[model samples]
Target: MATCQPAPTCAPVATCQPAPTSQAVCPQPCPIPAQFGCGPLPKITNLVCATDFDKAYIPAMYQHNMDIIAVASVGAEMAPSDDITDLAIKIRNERIQQNQKLALFARQAGYGALPVDYNEVAMYRNQLMGVAGMDFSARWATLMVGLLQQSQQSAQLAATRATLPQLRDQGNINARACANEIDALQRWLARNGLPVSATAVPGVCPPGAIAAPYGTGPSAPICQPTCQPTCQPAAQPTCPPGSQPAYPPAPVY
Candidate 1:
């Protein structure tokens, strides 16, 4: 008991530890963030389609269409045919009559009524001497020659006028056929739900291709309707009291 009491009375000694060395703080490498999404984007769909477009034959069909377009464009240039030869003849006949009248007046005025051309006068004088003898009036003879010449010229014009109608009709037929073919193609494309816009596909034709520089309208001029004059009945006259009114006929009468 005496030994334990003596040991408890002694004081305990304290030990000192060294300070921590402050090395530069090292940084650790960071990992990339994980991505969360609905997977890869879906492929876009092609809306335009041709029922007959088998990859094998599509190019040929396209080329054929282009050829048709080319011919159709050229065909549209054909003009409609018309025959105005009767009108032309009437015009010439009128001109000849006027000249004859002028010649007749010249003769009556005591002026030298010889033919305008020296050669024509000589030819007329010869013909007159051979046909009607020297007794025929020179002025009348020359006028007859002029009339004959005019008749001949008119006949030649009529002959020439008849020749071009066949060619013109052919051209018009070709043009119409081409137009129909083109229209059918357009309708088919529309029915098949094919793209009609030029920009819809690379190298495609524009929407105007169906009607412009390519497909033109009919070249024939429209025939205007004749303005028929109507005869209106005259209005009845009105009397003022005991006096009768003097009335002019209706304006259309």
Candidate 2:
């Protein structure tokens, strides 16, 4: 009757929720052509292609540096040191071995591999090498002509010097062409669903068909150099116990 008895004391009740499923998301394996051996062709995604293409610079620069050395050795007051040449040779051989591995991996990928771009990268590199060789020979000839007749020396040297820019321009063109090819290859890979780029479009979109936000810049160029991986030495494999080690030495060129 007096004031309400002490309010009934209540115990706290705990609530339990179901545990989350411990499922893992795995990418569907690539469809390996019958020729490639097992289950699925190794997934050669856009990223992988970019990586291999970037690795190409290894051989490209190797060839460039070797040509430079050869040219320098042609007519120098003192012969270029063997130490540097030997080092370059060693470095190039190692790079060549790596590129060979990459080529094998792609070939093994069989039909899953990205379409070949006419070996454009290699072609440009060869062109650059050829240009360098030609330049050296021309200069050597001019030098000989100069020594034979002092009067013709100045004119011959001048003529050769005038062509020097053209030679350099040709090399630049070749380098840029190679770089462009690398970009194209990445786009091809992305389109084929190798990496499945979010923004990559297989075919060209009609002009202004896809509108961009008010502030954003125009749609990205069909193919940009950004698509390609940086020009740096690729990560090398770890050496097994007691095996000779390989290091990514500095760029010779």
Candidate 3:
């Protein structure tokens, strides 16, 4: 009965303050996403090709090359001792080199060039197969003029249409050379009594080539007007008072 006595509260019941409840650390609310999406997947292809190419340019260039060969074969047999023959040979070699250069240019432009193994001379070599009893040189001369003209046109077209600067310049050179060669061939044909074409190519430079700075076109006349009086009427002089005016004085009649 003595243990059951209430234990005396030490210095008033210590106020048991509830442990301070720490505020719950609240995470910031995530913002709703503002983006959207699509419906179906797309189909794609893998095929590829060159971009920005002229379909006609390379073929026409090749044809021009063949034309050069065709005409070259005609003059190949000409004796080099002959000046005309020598000039023709020189032209042939030069043109071949130029054609190859242009072909290289074409290849660089993502376009196909004349194949290395291609037989440009094959057709020209057999040119005589069908012309029975016809003079091969003469007959070829007939075809040569036309082929040369076509080649020149091709060159001119390239000069105007080519995208490369070097190609355009080379094309202009070839065009002019081709024109001169055509004229020379015409004269040669006339001298040898071979057929000559009547067709004319405009815008071709004269035979007198550039002899001065920026003198690539037709020659300029002396711009300095004549110092002598040009507008004054001619002075009609009396033949020494008509002394023996006629030859032998009209036979002394």
Candidate 4:
């Protein structure tokens, strides 16, 4: 009994397991990770950001971004630095060159003009810039494809409108032929004892006459008044030889 108690009391039982430590269940709010953010560096410099169209199109950079910048900036003294001014001029020149190219392409494609506006192009450019490794070539190719489809639809509509007159003429010819055939059939029916009164003709059917059967039956047949013969005197019987001669009356006007 004494040996068992001594073995049990040895070292107050030190366990091999480490003590429990509390850890945060979820991470605290932090800025977006570097991989998820735009540009190689997590933040963009004002000069580099100014190259972006969205930033350049803001009210602050409106004078730099717009073609009519000089006129608009007059008396409003918020002139950009020389570097920004040069960038704006370059952007404007590049846009003019692209527009000339687009116009040439439109002419070749038989399109009167491109349907998109400069604002749409700028928005598309901004989207491309937001995406890493995206460039203008791919975006413009997609836009041109869409424009071609729209032009084809417009051409089809024009062709349809052009043929509308021919279609109307064909309709009129068919309607006239139908009316002629209806009149001939009505004449034939009238001559074959299916006597149709003048009022019973097409569009002028008599009050109660509405496509009734051709033969006489429960439906009453319309009657026409018959012509009467003119009155004439019958030949007088010969008088007996001995009888007094019948007197002939003298005519007087």
lDDT of 4 by residue, 140-186 (tens): 22222222222222222223332234323322432343244334424
Residue 124 CA displacement from its true place in model 1, Å:
64
Off by over 4 Å in 1: 1-163, 197-253
- Residue runs of model 2 more than 4 Å from their true location after superposition: 1-79, 111-253
- The prediction achieving the highest lDDT against the true structure is 3
Worst 10 residues of 2 by lDDT: 35-44
Error of 1 at 69 (Å): 10
User: Rank by lDDT, descending?
Assistant: 3, 2, 4, 1
Residue 60 shift from truth in candidate 3, angstroms: 2.6
Q: Give the TM-score of candidate 3.
A: 0.48
Candidate 3, residues 1-253, lDDT tens digits: the string is 4566555543332223334434434333222111100000000000001122234455445554654564565556643336445655766787678767767877887667564323445544455344432254555555556556555655665687666778778778988987887787688778877657622211211122111222111211101111222254434443443242333222211
lDDT of each: 0.27, 0.30, 0.47, 0.29
How well does model 4 score by local distance difference test? Answer: 0.29
TM-score of 1: 0.16
Please give, for residues 37-126, the per-residue lDDT of candidate 1 as tens digits: 101100000001112212211222222222222222222222111111222233334434434443444455444443333332243234
Query: Which pairs clash in model 2?
Result: 32-41
Candidate 1 Cα RMSD (Å):
46.1
